[model samples]
Target: MVDSLSELMIILNRTYKEGNVFKKVVKQIPEVEAAKIGEISKRISKAKQTVFEATAHLDRQVWQETKTSAQQGRIAAEATRKTAHDIRARVIDLQQETSEGHDKLSSQVDQFRSQMVDAADQMGDQLAQTKRQITKDGEERKQFEAGLQRLVDALPASIHEQLQSALYQFVADAIVQRQLFALPSNIISPNSPPLPLVQYAQVLSESDIINLLQTPDPIGDADRILRKESLMSDEALGYATLLRQKRQFKEWLSSDWPSLVLVDGCSRGESVGRTSPMSFFTASFASTLIRAETGIVLQFFCGHHIDPQKENSGPKGLLRSIISQLILYPKSYNLSLNFVDQGLYDAVAASNTEALCYFFEKLFWQIQPDTIIYVLIDSVSDFESDLHDYGERMDRVLILFQTLIGQVLQGFAAGPKLKLFMTSPNRSHRLIYRVDQAKESIRLNAAALGDISRSGERSLREIRRARSPLSYIM
Candidate 1:
């Protein structure tokens, strides 16, 4: 029993010792945990310090960024202020310019309105003046018409009828002629009295004689004749002589009384050729006189053909052409007054030589005083000279012209100034002699013409030499 008790005591003692060891292990575990906790606390403190330092650095960086941001914002605000100021300045300038432009436009509009008003006023004044003038013209026209009616009523019925018919026919012919020649019809006023023949004549200008002649173009004929004769050159002596003669002819034209100029081509001691320089000269001169528009120029170009049917080539043709020209003459006062001359009309229509002579004589008397009449007879030698009674016929023509010339020389105070220009070949010596009795005569010769030509050539050569480059260089 005592042994069992001692083993129990030993077991109890070992249990106690094991309990103390567990307690000490428990205590050591706590110390080890405390040490580890201290190390962890130190590590946590270091980490916290590092975290605070990093936070401070971050705060500093954030503050610097905020300050930089504020500076940039300030700088942006300044730039924006400057930009706003510039915008305001630009807006002010634009408004000022707009105001100036509006003011200028308004001023221009006002000036234009004033000009328009002035123009309207001037236009109204001009219109009023025109109306007044038109009224005055109407009164004068009525008075003139009343006087014309009174004069017409005083005439015998038969005479009035004849006058009316003649006037109507004349007016119709004038209108027809105007249309045919493409002449302006403005002279014939639609409102004017149809029988105002004198007034109409005054309004109408004398036109080209070709309108009446109805012959081949005389100007072209003249040019052709001149070219064919080789007398077209101005430097030629013959042409020069002819020019002198033309000037003399123009001088004769200035004479107050009836004068005759006879150009004898055969005086140059040449045969009675178909064409002569004198013929061309006469034709061209007649054309020039007609163009002068100073007087009545009647021309008869006796073409080479002497067919009686061709009235422009014979004596009958001459009378017909002259009468037609006279009919167209601007001096229509006497013609209109004495237009009832049936004999003259019949003679013209029939183409009778004797009747034409009588008609021409009567018509010649009817020409207004101070009026100039030019009769140009070119190539008179071609007047039926082949016939047996050529001299007799030519003498008759000569007598007719001489009678008219003599009448003019007798100084009928109321007669027109007449000038007769004739070109003839020396084939008819008697005819030439009769013409030579005239106040003016031109006799052309080959020798004199040759001398003049040689002198002209020498002069031309000298002139050329003077103008030459070689002469200038020398």
Candidate 2:
């Protein structure tokens, strides 16, 4: 029994030892669970640490981006400010340049004004000087014209042509530069007349003469004229002769009779060949007399041609025919009141001086005019030589009126006044000689006759160039 109990106790002891080993295993299992839990915690801690590092990297990148953006914005603002400053500087420079140009223009305007003022003052001075000079010249010219008028009026009728030509030349020299002038190329005269003393042409009026020289139109004449119409027209001497014959002495009253007379040519006929006429008939002479102040005076010119048949054939016909008509005219005067022989002669001879002088004296004694009678003869060369032949004939012919003057002087207590003018042709022609004892008595000596010359050729050339007065003056 004891042996069996000992075995059981030993087995139980072994089993208890195994149970302690199991307990130890169980305690080791709890420690393993704790270790597992610690490992998981370590892994979780690593993940969290990775997340924190990623978050820190993202924060740094964001900070860098924001700083760079701010720097770029500041740089852009600086550029805008610089551009604005440069634009302002250019605007200021342009304004200064414009102001400088305006100042220069203003200076030029002031200079132009100064020059204009000086020019105006100079023009005023010239105007004043010219006015004074014109006044002085006018006075001198007036006095000269008056002297010319008086001198020309005093010239005797006999030398009017030479004198007139000389006068024209003097005027031309003073006024003009040329002498191209139109002259009368044709002059026609007929032989028929009412009396031997041919009166001024009755039908051919002054205007008719002018028209004849102007445009002379012949009725139904298909032929051309001798002279150009314009040459003989109003531009030349168409009516100049009319102007020269203003005074008619025959119509003058006793108080209005002419004291001075002028004549042109003596007689134009064949009668001049035998006896040159030194004296003229009283009635015929009176017809062509003019006084400077009063009375009718005429200028009668007989052309050089005596007759067509004679050497110096005048216009035409004979002087004997012309003189016969005058002698045939009946004498009509009272013998009781008039002098029957004082200045009257019944004889009619062609070449007798005594007959001519008595006839001349008879004509003068009939007229009793108030003014002094003055006779003007153009030339003594035209008188016939055979007319003055004998001594008794020459005495009566030369001083036939001296005895009548003595009788009239005693009866009326004074004598009728008479003056004579005998002009000559050439400087050599003897026109006057001592007719009586009276040396102071008066006679036109041929040597005393003034010789007039034609004007210079150069002077004529200049006058002809003068522009026509009708063209511009009128």
Candidate 3:
């Protein structure tokens, strides 16, 4: 018990020593060192008592924590083992279910395979039956066709020919009517060949239908059918356009007569003109002028069938038309009346527009004072465009034409001046300005001029605002 108290004393002393403030206060008591040492002894006793109680409480807490921790660990281990056992049971069940499903699938596969075999056999029988039916139908068709052919062969040649002719005529009529309605009159060509379908009708309509009956050459018939089918397709709308142009021509003649008139809108690029290009328009214009017989319509429709080249300025057809007229009516041009029958004009000399220019001027001067000479030169731009060097050829031609007209006007102190009319694509070109700058440029009737002026100014303003100065040069 004494040794125990001694150990308790040491424990108490160590606990007090660790409390540095209390130890320092106790040690600094210099005046009452003995009394302070006694108080330290009392403190040591109290501290020992307190340490004994704290030790007992700590020991109890450690024992409780250890027991609780051991119980928790044992419970966690039990739960883990139970969960693993459940998972193993589930795995076994899944394996058994998978085996059963696999067996069922195998059975199903066997049943499906048997069904597929049965279906295949049935399909094979059906296909064979179908093929046999098709063969029977083909044989019947061939027999029927042969019998019909024989009957046709027995018919009289004259009867067959009449029937063939009637059939072809019917077909031709139907095609022509159908093509006429297919497009608007303004878009179609009035002059193109009747539907190439006509040729097929011709095969029947021709004198050779009897030959077809006599020969029965299947290969030749097949070739003809193929050729008919391959014939070039209808490229232009017809009937309506012809009618419309004719009507328009009548209206123009009634309105503008006796005065030298210029038919100027002739560019493909100029949207302001008729949607139909100059080529199409000129045909109608020339046709009307010819029919009118108002005066000579000297037409120079350059680049009509040929590519625009320098040599294509005046087509030979133009020269022919002019020469023919001069020969037929030499008196019309103030030449001696005898010259008409003799065809005295030098055909070689009047071959081109340049050579024929003098003749044209004389003809212009001599026309009946009341009759206006309409000079229709359509799509001059097409020829001008191809001239390159920026319309140099056209520039020279314009100058020559101007000089010729000036001389003609001076020579013909009387009446019937050549109505010098031409067209350009737009206002940017020199030709448009050159003609525009002329003293007696054809004036648009008053109201029309005002509308054109306002529209032109508006267009110019928009163009100027939209485009740069450099683009103007181009």
Candidate 4:
């Protein structure tokens, strides 16, 4: 019994030691110095950023609770938009007045010409008197009479030609010369009395057009179509800009066009494309007014004949490539037609202004053109935008287009080297041209004529072949 008791007590002691030790271990966590140090290290830099972000979040919440800043933003943008719209309208008004002035000036030229011709009779009489006074004997008188006859035969047809010769004679006579006319500041400032579209519409009228047309004019069988651009209709507006690069071009040429002759597109490292560069250089050098010779041609494929369906990319690339070729080989160069999609159509269709801006940013620099041209064709039968009827202007569409033009114009303002040329897509788009708070009719008299073809055919035949007596129009 003593041995069994001793064995039982030893077994009980062993079980207690194993079970109690395991319980102690399960109840407590072991300490680690390395883990502590690592966790402390987290507070060094990365954690500092988190702390800063948290503090910023807290500060933002406090500011949102305490302060008001609703009107600060978009202040400049609103002002800018208002200014632009105002300027656009003003430009149109001024341009119309300027056109009238041009017509008046042309008429004045004709009257001036008549006066000069009238003075020719007086000049003949003076010559006869002078000839008689200079004659000494029969032989001298005969020669003087012959010279006077020659003078009568050699009378100039144009007043300008006469004045030029007269000026030469005055110079020979040692007479002090002065200009006869001093043009008004309005005559010279194309940008003056600048009115926005709203301001222009407020004052413009049919009377203005009639008055402008009354100025002295040459007789022409064809009724002239006044070319104009529709600023409000553009969906995407593209502007190409080039600074005074002639200075750099000069510097480049001095270095034998080393930097000017690059070949690569993406991987090009400070190298100019030789083929295009060469052609550009050759033509430019020949054409530049650097010396006595004026090297460029005056003709333009100025007419619009581009296929609407074509992207204008292939044609543009081909045109550029040909120019490059011409540069590679020096010769007399003339660009028969300027491919002028420039950017209006594309910018209008762009999903956002950012795309349009980025597009023009490169394009403007690449073409380095002196004049920018915009062409839009309007057909009565053409499909209208899904949002508007054929004759109506949609405000939403206008707003979108206005936004685009604003962006493009801002790009242009940054670089005035680019002069924008724009054309309305169609004469039938009276929605854009008719005078009201919205449409300015002077830019287009077509709308005033009214729709002759109910079927949307704009041809003369459509009017002449009208099935109804009421369809006839002048």
Estimate every model's Cα lDDT from 0 to 1.
0.60, 0.35, 0.45, 0.32
Which lDDT tens digits does candidate 4 get at residues 30-53?
Answer: 345335434455545566788899
Task: Output candidate 2 Cα RMSD.
Answer: 42.6
Q: What is the lDDT of residue 106 in candidate 2?
A: 76
For candidate 2, the lDDT comes to 0.35
Model 1: residues >4 Å from true position, as ranges? 1-254, 267-274, 309-312, 329-334, 337-347, 384-390, 425-427, 436-438, 453-474
Residue pair clashes in candidate 1: 311-317
List ranges where model 2 is wrong by over 4 Å. 1-346, 349-352, 369-371, 384-396, 401-416, 427-431, 435-474
Better of 2 and 4 by TM-score: 2
Best by lDDT, which number? 1
Count of steric clashes across candidates, in order: 1, 32, 3, 26
**Reference-based TM-score of each model:** 0.45, 0.25, 0.32, 0.19
List model 2 lDDT by residue over 127-207, tens digit each: 777777777767767777778777767777667779778899999775322111111122111111112333333333323
Worst 10 residues of 1 by lDDT: 465-474
TM-score of 3: 0.32
Ranking by lDDT: 1, 3, 2, 4
TM-score of candidate 1 against the unseen true structure: 0.45
lDDT of 4 at 176: 17
